[model samples]
Target chain A: MHEMALAEELLKISDEAAASAGAEEVLRVGVGVGWLLQVERQSLAFYLEALRRDYPRLEHAVFELDEEAVRVRCRVCGEETEQAGWGFACGACGDRDVEVVAGDRLEVRDMEVRTDDV
Target chain B: MCETQGEGHQHRHLEVHRHAMEANDQVAARLRRGFAARGILVLNLISAPGSGKTALLERTLEQLRPLRVSVLVGDVETERDAERLRRCGVPVAQIVTAGTCHLEAGMVESHLAEVDQRELDVLIVENVGNLVCPSGFDLGEDLKVVLVSTTEGEDKPLKYPAIFHRAELALLTKADLAPHLDFDREELLRNIQAVHPGMKVLEVSAKTGLGLDLWLDWIRAKVGEKQSLHV
Candidate 1:
């Protein structure tokens, strides 16, 4: 439900970046989704495709998704490891006091654009 | 044809590096600044449905009767919670999210405009009962309070670690029922500590008024802290 809104934001940002760069069209946009955000990638992609139809400049654009991993540091053993799921227990010492390091970011990493000089 | 077309057009890779939630975060930051300037302490309460959030708040409001406090209730669709809070004699506003599972900063910012910020010491935003989506969205509150009940089992903090990790304080509601149920206190506390090592936990039974004083005192301390900063 909210993914559509998020997807719209991504497109708006991409469009603005493209326009500022004097690009004729966006070729591809890279998005990084954090594990904690729980955004549905497929739904976001679908919405991106449907909304792009309204913009001729984005008709040829592709939305790429990159899922980030949850990394944590154990408070007991001081071990840092990537969590496979929501379990925050340390893999080595089985300590529950593991601090989350990353994977809580949602950002547009980069974009490829084509200039009007064609 | 590919080589000819590639030679004719200029393709460039641009670094756009922007947060996807930038729009919401910006509004949330603005609201935080606005609250600080007004010396208002805002708290966003989040929990799973039936985790006793509204009930706890109702009791809390009654316990802190003399305090100037207001509430903003968020629900999928209902004025029931708002009406219930109104009985406590505080100005309450109901924000119907329509179908959204969580309350975003924009919603809070808009509803906040209707309330006179200068008149209140505390503004409580009861988020739409959800642990997942609400944890990811910042509502510009000074603190995020997560509630879990004894009946929900001790593993709840482990099951929904995201909410636990994001919360500054975890309130173990329905503490009166702990004796009747097989709720493992040590296990639950350990789980919460695991997710947030330094997160503060409070046990209170809104029904029995047990531990209610501590809760009220905490609120007062926080309010005083916020006021002193502006002074």
Candidate 2:
């Protein structure tokens, strides 16, 4: 699955960040998956854990993933709201002329790590 | 017992952006800049396995005369699609992912040598026959077009919104077989709008040469837009 690729990227990116920050051990990682893209959280979590052992600094790392909900701005009604999980339409008006203002982002948000000294 | 929260072992938290797509996105952006600077219009074509992407591409290559077009196609294995496209008398390259589901930007970047950007007006990438994974990754194309065959159900757009949402245009292929089948054209258009409102759709059949002129015009317009930017 593509989750494997995403997980590998997370480790590589996190490892680089950890190394640059002089982190001795990566304690936690944060990843944000967009709802529109449809990346499964459990599958991503599994791969992140499965691949952590490869990166020495991330051997003890735990991942925290957040799903960014899709938000749309309606053109006809000028209403903005979160999509109701499936087929998208204006929540206020029944118009389909809406623009996606948020969501569809697949990214690593922030991470926490342990350094060599306090 | 330890005196503190690990007495001498220090801890720190950093708000960093090591996104899952950071590396890929960076590569894609660079590729996009290169293509734009060279005055090239790159279109990434994505669809299901039997959606006739190669057939449509063959028709396009044949009809887009004097356009100086090149192609880069991807599949899990084999150079078959590349061979089929080569018959159209244009430069073509086949990228074998060796079991990967989709093509990444780095994979495409490595194949840049296959085509001479200086002599090319447009570059078409035939993505691996998949709807989901390919839509998730970006390859720095100016536009992403999804092809849907008439044999498939009309709800394809609603079923796979990721790619539909990513695409600015939709191609309903195999229009010649429409009368023989029970497919509702209006329903399909409605479904496409449900996911992507106001998306330009063209009903084309590569086999029967239906609506090829309209499709070609769309391509010409896109290429012209890019060339104008360079001037």
Most TM-score-accurate candidate: 2
On DockQ, the leading prediction is 2
For candidate 2 chain A, which ten residues in a row score worst on lDDT? A109-118
After the best TM-score superposition of candidate 1, give how far the Cα of residue A53 lies from its true spot, in angstroms: 4.2
**What's the TM-score of each model vs. the native?**
0.86, 0.91
| Model 2 clash number | 1
Residue A97 in model 1: lDDT: 78
lDDT tens readout by residue for model 2, B96-133: 99998899999999998999889999999999999888
Docking class of 2: medium
Tell the DockQ for candidate 1.
0.53
Model 2 chain B: which ten-residue window has the lowest total lDDT?
Answer: B1-10
Which ranges of candidate 2 are over 4 A from the true structure?
A72-80, A85-101, B1-5
Tell me the lDDT of model 1 at A75: 90
Q: Write the residue-wise lDDT of candidate 1 on B30-109 in tens digits.
A: 99998899899999999999988889899889877677899999999989999998998888889999998889899998
Q: Model 1's chain B TM-score?
A: 0.94
